[model samples]
Target: MKFPIAALLLCLAVSGASAEATYGAPPSGLADHLARLKRAYPDVILDYDKTKLTLKSGATIPISDGRRDKSFDELLDEPDIDDMFAFPYPAHAKPAAPAFNADPGRVRVESLFREIYGDCRQGAAALKMRRVPWFGGSVLITTRQGVDKALEAVSRDLEKLPKAMQKYLAPSAGTFNCRAIAGTTRLSTHAYGASIDLNTDFANYWRWSKAGKDRKVTWTNRIPAEIVDVFERHGFIWGGRWYHFDTMHFEYRPELLAR
Candidate 1:
């Protein structure tokens, strides 16, 4: 059987840039990527056979969709399971500025999340949300997969911080809001009840800042390193690390933040 020319072309296309990250195709680093994922979330991942996975649901999902040409927008809008690891997450690398396109943990596969946390549209996900006490008040967070336990541990440590740090932690901006991100159809990590945003007064977002004439966003952070460190130690990734920085956002993505 003769192979299609399109297939041949795709093979060549993916081969040329297999090191850094590929937009549309399955990256060559599939094994290492999946290994890290399984190590991070052992509950839902179950097992994989390199090319596909037998999820805890007993359903099989392909690791790649096989397309080789995708723009940044396309990668965000439509990504396969492997595409989630296209960009290598710089876990505990530093607080320095990241490269232009290094929003590693941002490229999430919706189905993977849906499988573990349940679909938000059906309200199944929200039912798992539980309130965790923080700064003397309770904030709703997910109880699934030890999330509530992890947050409780975080709160315990946070309480020991100096009195000055208390102001930034509360009044809590929000948590467990089941809604899509503003201006995009994709749901915010907050919707999964696995993320939280601190007080808005001390927070910063790229959208509110003015970009340069060259269109590069100026990164700014003001939430204090102490608070960021506490969250990082507790298995959360900080939004201040991204090129399009958001100072007050922290999501529980342990895989991206090495302990």
Candidate 2:
């Protein structure tokens, strides 16, 4: 049977339109995510492939370990690069209690973090430290990827807020301490000198809060949205957003916040 040329032409036009629509769609998926990672740290992430990320130092890190059965704790402890996105960071969203185990920027891959911010164990991170002025004081932060500058930008914006908000920022709990996270052998982001903890007085941590009969730690935040907003705009993510809340904590994680 012979097909009608007019109908054939009409079908062809529709097919072309469909293809164009798909091609023009907003970027998503692994390739786009990888490109964002490269853009987030142009100096460190040289390039990436389907399975690995190549660093400027001539080293490569696997993107995934091919394990999808990891428990929440395992994802935190043995995370690969892909696991870092286990939870999509809800950047700029109104602050609210996150669902259980919804810690977006918490599943860090130690190797990638060490690559971006030098490991502090051998005093390498300290070597890159720059003292940026905070509220009436200074905090030691890393110069890597201009993270010190990011913190400075955050401080400047925070100062613009009403004076009462200053209480939450002044006398920062600390920054740039080469210490492991509580109850874990893994190094905290603080160890990389890329994190800042606001005043401990207003801080609320899951470990410090009482759990209900259901064993769920109640979420609480004393830090104002104004403070979290400034930090996030400058590539810092608030720990208070995590289900395992740490209200005074904010760490620089540009990759997670990239659009």
Candidate 3:
């Protein structure tokens, strides 16, 4: 006996649909995830216009349609709402490996930051900078865009941590340098004073991982979750979460945590 042609087609269709549902779509709770982030860090999200995210400080960033990297100038000029979530957060209750193309906080357009924070290299603007005491000593950082207040908040919370944890933060790594990324002309978060790296000994850098060409990076983390939770609660995201991990660093990109 032979099966009917239509029945076979229907079976194939169902199988294809199941496969798509299993692997093609992202997790369904993006809205809920954003809500959790909002609850954790209130007032961080200024505006959520369709594809544009305007921060409370009146800086607007354009979210891309998930295609390409926006230039520093382009990112600064007009960032969309989607751009805010370019960096990914933990999607499950337990820490699972990140999905392919799971880089959530990776999307940044440099100009958007340079506009609000001022170009640090110019020297004309960065002169208005101030210092925040990270552990015991202080580190000079930019004051533009309420960043000083945010870092102060971060410091206050970090100070409450146990002494062992605090040691990883001091003898600071420096901040507010007007320099491009290590290898590229693109500006780094360090250039804006929006980023900080903890003690070098306690951190991890992707370049340090040497596998063969096209070698898979092994994700290793020693920084306590307690430290990361504190930073995220204050609207900072950990570099440890990135595929290209920088375990001892955190940056102030509240828009990414904004709902």
Candidate 2 off by > 4 Å:
1-28, 124-127, 212-215
TM-score of 3: 0.68
Determine the backbone clash count of candidate 1. 0
Per residue, candidate 3 scores C-alpha lDDT tens digits across 1-259 of: 3668889999997775444312112234545544543444344346454355456667656544453445433433344434445445752123334553344565555655566567767774653678777676788776665667878888888778898887678766777677876756777788778778888878777668774544457677777777777777776777777766777778876645643
Off by over 4 Å in 3: 1-84, 91-97, 124-127
TM-score of model 1 (CA atoms): 0.84
> Which segments of model 1 are wrong by more than 4 Å?
1-22, 25-29, 124-126, 212-214
**Winner of 1 and 2 under lDDT:** 2
TM-score to native of every candidate shown: 0.84, 0.86, 0.68
Ranking by TM-score: 2, 1, 3
lDDT: worst 10-residue window of model 1: 16-25
Ten-residue stretch with the least lDDT total in model 2: 19-28
Better of 1 and 3 by TM-score: 1
The sequence of per-residue lDDT tens digits that candidate 2 reaches over residues 24-110 is 111236666677788888999998988899999999998877776565667788888777776778888889999877888888888
> For residues 1-259, what per-residue lDDT tens digits would candidate 1 score against the true structure?
3668888888887775454344776766677777867776777888887678668888777888887777666788888888877766565455667777667677888878877677767884454887888886889888777778888887888888898988888878998888987779998888888888888999888889898764477777777777777787877888887776787788887766644
